[model samples]
Target: MSLSIGLVVHASRRGVFEEAVESLSGISLKWVTYGHERDIRPLVRSLVDGHALDGLLVGAVPYRACRDVLPPRLPVAVPRSSALDLALALSQAQVRGWQPVPVSIDTFDHEVVAEVTEALHLDRTRVTCLPYDDDQSVDDICAFHQRSLKEGSGYVITARTAVLRQLRGALRVLNGSPVPSSIRSELHELVSRVRHERAGASGFAAGVFCVGRHGRPGDLERSRTGLLHLLRATPELTDAWIEDRGRRGVLVLGRRTLFERFSRNWLVVPVLDQARESLGVRVAAGFGVGPSARTSVVLAERAAVRAESENRPCGYLMEDSGLVVGPMGPGGPPRTGLHRDQDDRDRDQGDRLRELARTVGLSTATLSRLAAIEQDLAGRTVTPSELADAMAITDPSGRRLLRKLHAHGLASSEGSAQTHRKGRPTGLYRLAIDAALTGSADGHPLTAV
Candidate 1:
C-alpha cells in the first residue's frame, strides 16, 4: 500500500483546511474529515476506529478535542501559526483613535484560542465566543464597535470563516488589519528556492563553521541578517541555524548538497566573519572537504573546543584533509575516552553527544554508545554482539537501539543472510546520513533511512 496519511482539522474552516491538504498533492495522501457532526464524540470515535495511520497533519484544533483521540505513535505535522500575525492583529486592535473601542468574539477551538492568547496576552473580557451565527449583519458589527467604544476597549472576535470574514471587514473600520503577507511570503519563497538549489548539488564540498565569544545579546540576530545579505550578494553558499529557547546564540553548519537546490550561498562565511570582527569578537572556523552535515556539526564542536582551549581573541578550526587550525589541532574524532577524561573533556564530549542526539533523534546515552561503536569499528569489521558488548548493552538492547536510529533516519537496515540463521534473513543496521539544518526540504527529509 502507498503509505496512507490523513489530514485532520476542525470542520468549521474546511476551506482553508482542505486548501492546506491539497497543497500536499503529488505526495501520498488521504483525509479523515471531522467537526461536521453536532458533537465531537463521533469524530473522536472515528479516529480511534480508523485503520492504521502512517502520519497525521493537524491544523490549529483544540488539544482537548484530540487529547484522547490521536494515537501517540502517529507522527504529526502542524502549521506553526506565525506569532507575527497575532501581534499585528492585536496592535491594530489597540489603536483607539482609528475606531471605537474594539472587541473580539472568537469561536476558535480551545487550542487556537490558547495559542493566540498566549501569543498576544489578550484579555477575555474584550472578546466573545459565538462560533456560528446565521444573521450577523453590518448593523451588529457596528453595535459591537459602539459597545467596545463605550467600554473603552476593543472587540476581539474569533470565528471560523464567516466570523473571520466579517471581523476582517468590521475590524478594518477600527483600523484593525492583518499585516501584509507579501514580504513574509517573499522571504519564505526565497529561502525555499535556495533549499531546492543546494539539494540538487552533490553536497557541500567546503563549509565554514564560525564560533564567536564575547558577542552581543543580539549577535545571533545580527549574524543572521549579515548572512542573509551575504547570501544575496554571493548566492553560492547555503547555510542553516536554529534560534529556539534552548539554543538562541549557538550556530550550526551543514552540507548544502543534502539539502534542496538554491541552498548554497558562498557569502555566509566571510560575511559572518566580518560581522564578528566588527563586533570585536573572535571566532573559529571549521572547513572540511565534502563533509556531511553531521560531520560539520562535529567539526563545529571541534572549533568551539579549540576556541575555548586557546582563550585567544578568536579560534579557528577547519578540516581540509589534515590542515588543522585552532587549539584542538585537527578535525579528527574525540581522542579522550569516557573512562579516562578530565572534567572539561568529558563535558565537551557530553555537549557533542547531546548535539548529535538532537540531530539524529537518539538519546544522549545512545549516541555516546554509538560513537564508541564507531570508534571500535573504525578500520575494522566486528560482529553485532561485539559492538554491543563494547557499548555495555545487551544484544536485545542493541537491536532496539538500532531500531530507534533507523526510525529517525540516522541508520539503515540491510537484510544480511550471513547474519541470520532463521527462516528469513533479519536486518542489520548501519549508519545512514547525518541530520543537518539547511533549508526546508533538508529540514524535513521525505524518506527515513
Candidate 2:
C-alpha cells in the first residue's frame, strides 16, 4: 500500500528535511509548512481534516501545538534532538574557530548536553542548557539564549530553526536541525510503524455500554433503548453492529480500526456525552480486543465493569495481550499493561508469574501482563509519563505507579531526566521484573524499571 505521511515542519528547516527525498520512495507526501510556531495549529488542522494520511511526522513544538487536532491513533513520530545532533553542532562550532564551553543551548535535553560537552572535556559549568518541552515557545527559547549571552556565553545552539532565525543577526546561533541522515532514518522508521499498524487494523473489537443509575425498571428500559439508538445514529459508528446487551446496556461489535476512529482512538467517546446530554443518562462504556467474538465480548464486559467503578461515567479497554487502557471519559485514566498484541504465551510460564505476582502483591495475570511490557521495552529506560502513555494511563497515575514500582523494587532508577528547562527532572527506570523472574523471587530487589 502507498502510505501518505503528513510532515509538519517549520519553513526554515524544510531544506534539511527535503534533503531526504530518497526516503520518500513509493510514499505520498503532504507537507504542512509553517513560518512561525503559531501557524502550526491551523495548518495541521487543515491537513488532518482534508488529507487521507496514514501517519504524521512532527517536531516537539508542532506536536504539542496541534496534538488536540490530530487523530489519536494516527501513527506519529517526533524526532528528538538526539546526542548526534548536538555533537555535530559542537563540532561545527569548533571548526568555525569557536569554543564549545560557555555555550548556551536550547531544546536539547540536559543529559544530552552534558554528555556532548563532557566528552569534549569542556567546562560543564560554563554550559547553560534549556531543555525542550511541548509548551516552550520561540520567544521562550530566544529568551534563554539572550539570558545566556548576558551571562558571557560565547554563542548559542538551537534545535529549532525559528530560534535560529529570531536571534541570528544579533547573536552567533548555530542551527541545530538534524542532518539529512537523521531525518531519513526517522522517516523510514515512521513508514515501518505506519505499515505495521495498518496491518493490525484488521483485529476484532467489542464495545459494552451500560447506563449508570436509573430510578425504575421502566426508566431503565427507556434509557437502554435510548443508548442503543444513540450508538446506532452516530455516524462514526455506522460500521459497527449494535444490539441490546441487557436491561440497561448495549453491545457494539466492529473492527479495531472502526472503533478507534469512533472513540478518537479511545481517548474520548462523544456518544457517551451525547447520551448524557440528550438521553439524560450516564453511559459507561468499555472496549476490548480479541481474535474471537466470545473472548472479545467477555473482555469488553469486564472492561465495562471496570469503567462503571470509576465514580463517574467513563470507558475502558482491555486487549487479549493484557493491556488495559481507559477511564476514557472527560479525560483519560490510569493504564498499566502491555501495548502490542502478542500471541498468547504458553501457560507453562505460569509458575514463575504466580511467584513474582505474590512477591509484588499483584495478580499473576497482571504480573504476566507486565512481563509483556518489559519485553516490549527491551532494555531501554522508561519514564512515568512514557510508561503511562504506553499503558494508556494518566500522568499522575504514571507517577504514582512509578513510585509504587520503585517502592516494591520492581524497577530500578537510572537517575532522573530533565523534562523541561525548569523544574525537577523526572526519574528514569529500568524494569527489574526480569531479574526476579529469572531467579528465586525471595532475593530479587524491586526497583523502578
Candidate 3:
C-alpha cells in the first residue's frame, strides 16, 4: 500500500517544498499539503481524524513550531538546518564583499549556531543567534533583526522561510534551506517508523492454560516441569508465565503469526497431550487476540473457563467479534478469521485505549498501571498516597508522574483533599483520558511528558 504523508510548509516556501516532494519519488507516496505554520495543529488534527495520512513531513516551519504543535502519535519528520547550510550562507556573504564577522542569525538555537560557527573556523563571538519562540510574533522577530543590525551586525541569516520572506530585499538576508539529502534521510526514517507502528496496531494473540490435577503432588510437579520445558523449546512463544505459581493457570503471549504456526504444527496440543499421556494430567486452554494486554487477559480467562467446561484437549480461539472458533485439536484448520470484523465493537474499545496511551506518549505498561489506579479510585479523585500505592512507585515518583500528566493536559488538579489535622493537605487529581484521546485538551499538544 502507498504510504500517505502530509507535508507542512509555509505558503511562501512552495518552491523548496516542491523540491522536497520531487526528491521522494522512490517511494509509493500520497501527499497532502498544509500551508502556514499557524494552521498546523488544526490541519494535522483534521488529517488524523479523517484518516488521510500515515505520517507528516514538516518541510519549512521553525523547528519549535513543529515540536510544540504536532500530535505525539503521528510520525513527524522535520529537516534541521545543518552546519553545511550555515557554511554556504557564510560563503555567499563573503562573496558579496560582506564581512563574515558580526553576522546575525535568526530561527536557530543559539548553541547550534555557535557550534556551527566554531566548526566552520569563524569567530563565535561575532555571530548573534536569535532563537524562535512560539510566543514571539513576526514583528518581534523583525524588530530583533533590525536591532541586531543597528548594533553593527553586517549580515542577517535566517532559517525560517516566513522570516526570510519578510526580511528579503529590505536587508542583506541570506536564506537557509534544509539540504535535500537531509530531507530525504529524515523521510526514509519516518516512513520506516510509520510502517512499524502500523504493523503493531493489528494486534497479537495470547493463550492461558489451566493445568489439571495429576492426583499426586509429585506427578503434578513433574507435569508442570515438562510443560515449562516444552514451552522453552518452542522458540515462537514470546513470553510464558505460571500464573499464581501454577495454581490458577499458565499464561502465554505471542504474535498472531507465531500462534498460527503453533496451531499448524500442533505444538501446544501435542505438549498438553504428552503431559496427559506420560503424567496422567489434563490441560484446559483458552486463546484470545486483542490490541492490548488487559483485553487479551480478559478474553483468555473467559476462553479458559469454556475449555475447562468442555474437558477437551483442544482450546478455543475467541475472535474480536465474539465468535468462538475451536475445540481446536491438532491440525484444526489453524483457526480462521484472525483479522475478521475490523469494526468489531470490543476491538474498537481496545484500540481506543491503545490510542489513549499513544496520545499521552506513555507506554502500554504505564497506561495499564494508570488504569489500575483509576479503577481503584472508583470515581473518587486520586490522592498522591493512593496513586503511589496503586502504581507501586515512591510517593515522589508518583507526584512527578501526576504532574507530567497534568503538563500534557491528560490530568487536571481539583483542589486538595480535606484533612482534619495536619501539615499540608494531599492534592487531588482527575484524569482526562477521553479529552486527551480526542485532542480536546485545553492547552499544550500532548508530547513526551
**Candidate of highest lDDT:** 2
Q: By summed lDDT, which 10 consecutive residues of candidate 1 come out lowest?
A: 259-268
Give me the displacement of residue 245 in model 2, in angstroms.
Answer: 7.4
Best-first order by lDDT? 2, 3, 1
Could you tell me the lDDT of residue 252 within candidate 2?
A: 97
Model 3 — which ten-residue stretch has the worst lDDT? 330-339
> What is the full ranking by TM-score, best candidate first?
2, 3, 1
TM-score of candidate 1 on Cα atoms, chains taken together: 0.30
User: Which segments of model 2 are wrong by more than 4 Å?
Assistant: 6-15, 19-21, 30-80, 94-99, 109-124, 131-147, 150-153, 160-173, 185-203, 209-239, 242-251, 257-285, 290-295, 308-314, 320-323, 329-449
Each model's TM-score?
Answer: 0.30, 0.53, 0.47
RMSD each, Å = 24.0, 14.8, 15.1
Stretches of model 3 off by over 4 angstroms after superposition: 23-51, 59-72, 200-251, 256-449
Score candidate 2 by lDDT. 0.74
Candidate 1 accuracy as lDDT: 0.41
lDDT of 2 by residue, 1-449 (tens): 68898898877778888887555687988999898768999999999999988878887678778877877456676776767888999998999999777788887655567567767888887888876654567887788788777955599888887778789888888977778787887788778756645554787889999998779898999999988988898887898999998877799998888987776555566676678778899888888888887888899999999889977877888988667865565321222343111101212233455544533334343455455567768989999889888766688867655554553457766887898999757879888776676653433232110
Q: Write the per-residue lDDT of candidate 3 for residues 1-449, one digit (tens) a residue.
A: 67877766665665666675585653555444455666766765565566656777764343345444555456655555655677778889988898887778875544346546766778876677765444567777777777777864487888766677788776778886665555666677678767755564456667787777656776667666666665566555544433333763667776655565555311234445555665456777787767776677778778778778876676756645444544544222122374234224323444555555544344433554465446445667887676777655788867756755654456666768666486657778877654444455544422210
Worst 10 residues of 2 by lDDT: 339-348
Q: Alpha carbon lDDT of residue 296, candidate 2?
A: 86
